[model samples]
Target: MKSLFSVSVLIPVLSISMIFNSWAQNPDFPWPEGKRMALSLSFDDARASNPDPGAALLDEYGVKATFYVVPSGMESDIAAWKEVVASGHEIGNHSLYHPCSGNFVWSRNKALEDYTLERMRSELSAANEEVERLLGVRPEVFAYPCGLTYVGKGERTQSYVPLIAEMFLSGRGWKDEAPVDPYYADMAQLTGMEMDNKSFEEILPLIEAAAENRQWLVLAGHETRTEGNQTTYLSMLRKLAAYANDPANGIWIAPVGEVAKYVKEKRAEMEGNLNIPGISRPAEGETIYLTAEKGKGIGPDIKYMPEWNAFGWFTAEDRVEWDLDLPEKGKYEVWMEWSVSDEEAGKPFVLTSGEQTLEGIVKPSGSWETFQKTKIGELALEEDFNRIIVASGEDFDEGALMDLKALTLVPVGK
Candidate 1:
């Protein structure tokens, strides 16, 4: 797994400590040895469906999954839960009563809004003890119930994440939109991508997108039954298993505990010294990329913004932003690649970098896929941590002017 990223060690070997210490978005982040992405198969709530067909299917694929369990939910399946542990799947604490927000209405009796920080800690510890008793294995990983992290309501509300951090190796949250950047992620609050009610086809793109950046993707799921609330279809699971098992995909699919532990160790080693091994820097001239689709930090989220020329064309919702790690700073040549139908020609846009702003007007570019890149005005930039924004001009509505494919920044000649 260490050999997968030669770039991870590039910085220390080159004696470039400046890039190492800073939170640089080094594109060459490594996955496990020879792997392209880190993926964790996880199910929450200790459903009885997990130990049987869930664990059984995971076994068939030679993949291990993390099961975040509730004590009471496992009462009837205690024996099966033990088998799941014996079979090498991880048992993670998912709280004793599984208290959620009062907004759920049905959970008003045991709502998180009523919990105190002390009570939350006690409940979590008691849940851990219960799992250890039933499965003879104590859990090190935790997932927030209903993806909720607070303990009280309104002004009195507080995050119980600190409590979980003290008790567990890592705590995972749900319904997150992006993958984890292991270099910067806090283990105690790792985010999980929701997998409920999704088909393998629907899930493949998420893995592919995360793999594009060589990051960790934790998928949170529930139940093996299909067509029900919070259920993940077994057929879809089988397909996901097949995709992950394929050597060609280069994904390191493991239990969350294993991945978290590995990330912690590897990061610590890199921090210690580059010669400790498996450290490298990302490649130079890496294009700062962005798209219409948004997730967590990745945005210009197409949902909240306007769409023009179809789903792929990126339009402005007032502004679009990208967090870029520029290799060097200077007057860079700007290139805007856009497609326009004759009717939607001449949309105005402003590209702002720091205090410098460059205005550009789009012209017809054949068609959507047949994009044309024209040199827009140049903007000055400083190296490292530059926020570049593309925004709408004074125009009010009338839809987007063109379909944007890519934005490029090339260094200008001295």
Candidate 2:
């Protein structure tokens, strides 16, 4: 007779297989050839080491990486840089003069804290023009100087992220903890993880995690050498390239701009296939309702309850998201129709769209069947396509959060 432990293990194994099959069929971002995730290798500062052995090693492995260059730094290595471009690598702007915060003693004279938005804008444009003139290919992506993105200081400080968003197809930051979510990440501020001075063993876990989440991993380094400070080891890179090249690993490795362009195209396709009516500008005094049936449910536990016309079985990990296309920017009052038993009350949840977020605690509605409408807060949304997500907060315990019926948005001062 089969052992009881064997039977128990068999059930979960079959369940996991089914889940994987379902995901393979309908992924959030359709990667080419059913690849699990994307990887982008990028280097910054236009280091001389990049063109010598860095690009050569990558060429041997059939890998394309992005090199963010300061035009002034490349003047001495023009021929090698040209060969890099001809070899099919991408070039991105790293800004002229490479301004950073005054906190760094070296950058004190060219500090961003002393610059105005107009001055910063002019510098960025000049860098792009110079790069195009020198390289024959316009830099379409950017990496923030020292990963800092602000002008001025104190209350007068303003972020230059908007400037980057307007100028480049994608802008990258350094020392980020996690990978980019292909569906939700802001193209202007993609996270760039550090790969310098790390061994293959140290970076394997990150690659595995990104593959598990089907996210995009953009690894950034300064130099590519055998062994040194702030360097990506050639040995480590060789191992990584071999691992990614194998068909079993299922990774799509390419340059930053290439992966960014593919993500944009895929996102547009997903939005067009949503099939739900787009949210447009309502007449004055009208409210927009996002119903449960219209919203997309993510995670394994969240499910729709047709009888109650709501989404139920919500766990801490579950999320409900909606897409909206607004004609103009406006401030709106936010409300929610939800139901939860007394035992599950006080569970916190957060609703977020763009950079705006509204946090609220779940109120007991006597029973899950009894729905109550409550005004949560107000938010100012930007014009164009916006993705809104409602997810459980950190305080959420082990239980159902709420049965969400609909979300309401009323234009403020309408």
Candidate 3:
């Protein structure tokens, strides 16, 4: 039997160390065997057309794509879906009843606005169980139904993204505007660009741009019919497979899970090998300050407060990152300057450098204005460039993570 998925075979001549060092200074990701970019073709809803001409066309070119299936929709096409699995394609969970916003009249009966976190979790778990029982493969990835991720309306609204992050290897969103930056992307919410109803000519530009930037492009669609609403035309798929398979085009195409796994493994490899000596810190090590103004905040709720020279309005989903190039490899004692209300003092946060992470609990400084400096923990530094991230821990709930002023990294023993 063929493998469930395929990955680009790395060339034996290029050592992993050599590849990491070469791309250490360059911004572009080092694709396997020097491919310019990566692409993943995925279809949602598991429409009958997907297993017929869609998977068939892909198999002809030795391409493996991802199929996010609604388990309830798979009853009529079990045989064809088994063939899809046999041909090395991926099967992902697309929920059970395909709940969407109540705005869509057809889905009003199964609307997300009426759901609670517990109910959504039950449905997702049931869907996984059904899919596994039917297809003999438990899905490792997921797709948000109708691109909607929340479970309620207004103040009651709760994002189920964290749930997906905990349950699957990755979760993909629909109708996203850009390709994923492997370096900074949140794996749980990968961007899925639409390929439905687009001609090959229309899609070529997106592929070309991704190539230039060495990014990962995930193309999503519904059916595989030649002409229909929400359909990924067979003609376009043929041309795309041909273009990607051509070595001259410099594209590495694979299933979504395969590409995501590769990106994670490569990042781990790169971070693991950063201990090699190349630069030197001064005899008297310097204290590196990552001020709030200098840090880049990601996610919806984190904000910079110029009045306090700090970042405030933090939530569990928010993260603050700082890019640095350490002059030497050594242990650095980490310290955080922040303030939080007494009620929010127990929230936990983690500081990560490469593979090492230092976890600390938020200290109560009485009020947000009264900042306190506390030594969190120490982490070993890498000589090369590193992205330091401070993120909320699993235990965080309704309270704010903290109002951060700055993070300091002082050399432990200079």
Candidate 4:
């Protein structure tokens, strides 16, 4: 049985239009491959231990994580750090000088209390530039140094969060209580759950909580050790890796940039669906436009919907092929728009992206004159070009099942 994970039910106070059909699934919540939630392990400060045995351990588990580093920390052992980057671990800007509150005493000399927002911005920019110069990857994600976001003192204090958002795809806050809600999480200040000084036993609850609601769980850590003050236990890391790698657990483990990109694309697609006016913009990922006699590689012998523009007369052997390019790999929600006749209402059809296949039902829309939009299912799309094929099901008869219209692929977040 499918569980409809509920998030607070509200007793409607205002009058709702009866005309509006409450959609069964939430398009806004983009969980891919039926995953329960997302998990991203992010380490802060470029300690020697991080790129050393730490990267090796992660590589062994086939797990990739984000390392937010101060360029200076890795400067002495730049080659080792480069190896970490080459191992598929993401490098995030943790600012040039790791500044913190003046109250810490250690940061009193170069405290945030004396610095301005402009100085912080410049520091972050320089950090990115230096990291890119050394590692050849410009970080699109950022983590606050010392988990602090403000600069200056008292009333003069200003948050550098806005500046970070302007520069990076995402910014993480440390020791946060909740996981990020893809529908509502501010990507600039993604909540970073505490994982430092934790055992796998202590971390499992956090993961379970996030999984319950399909939220994005970001584990924030400092060192990668077992006996240190702020160490994220290596044992815990291994266990987490094993859990995420198991398909039965239903967790999508990825780097910060990869997850952020998918969430952004999915959110944009949801917003576009709600945009009634001329405000909707183009969506990301694969989009095949096949309005009857139009689009690429669609055979010339096609039939159009009577008065509806798009073509019809789909045969069991006929298939539409579209070239799909994906920079950030994930699962995409496939949507099909077409007109259906009474006889074709129950016809079986299949949509595929590589090895991922989605079986869809042909729903009736009163008559073939009306074109309706419907969700087929989700399919995994990897990096680079994907040949998305659409054809009839094995049991489908070789006849005009439905009219050919358009199909869209939007990356779903997990």
- Give the clashing pairs for model 2: none
**Which one wins by lDDT: 2 or 4?**
2
Compute each candidate's TM-score over C-alphas.
Answer: 0.61, 0.70, 0.64, 0.61
Best by lDDT, which number?
A: 2
Q: Write the per-residue lDDT of candidate 4 for residues 48-75, one digit (tens) a residue.
A: 7898678888999899999999998898
Which one wins on TM-score?
A: 2
Q: Runs in model 3 with CA error above 4 Å?
A: 1-27, 272-414
Would you list the rank order by TM-score, best first? Answer: 2, 3, 1, 4
Model 1 C-alpha lDDT per residue in residues 1-414, reported as the tens digit of each score: 222111111111111121222111233556777798899988998888888888998899999999999988988977788889888999899999989999998889999999999999999889989988888989999999998999998999999888888999999999998998787787888989998899999999999988888889999999888578898888888999999989999999999999999988877655522211121222355443333231111223232212322122233443444556666766667777667776676666666666666665667776645667777766676776666655554443555556555567666674
- In model 3, what is the error at residue 89, expressed in angstroms? 0.5
Name the weakest run of 10 consecutive residues (lDDT summed) in model 3: 14-23
Q: How do the residues 1-414 of candidate 2 rate in per-residue lDDT, one tens digit apiece?
A: 422111011111011122211011224467889999999999999998999899999999999999999999899989999999999999999998899999999999999999899998898899989988888999999999888889999998999999999999999999999999887789999999999999999999999999998999999999999988989999989999999999899999999999999999988876523323234444444687788756766666776665666776555656777887777878888889999999988776777776566666787998988999988877777777777777775534478889988899989987
The deviation in Å at residue 172 for candidate 1 is: 0.6
**What is the Cα root-mean-square deviation between model 3 and the actual structure?**
18.9
Please give the lDDT score at residue 253 for candidate 3.
97
* Candidate 1 RMSD computed on C-alpha atoms after optimal superposition onto the true structure: 15.8
Cα-based lDDT at residue 309, candidate 4: 47
**On a 0 to 100 scale, what is the lDDT of residue 64 in model 3?**
97
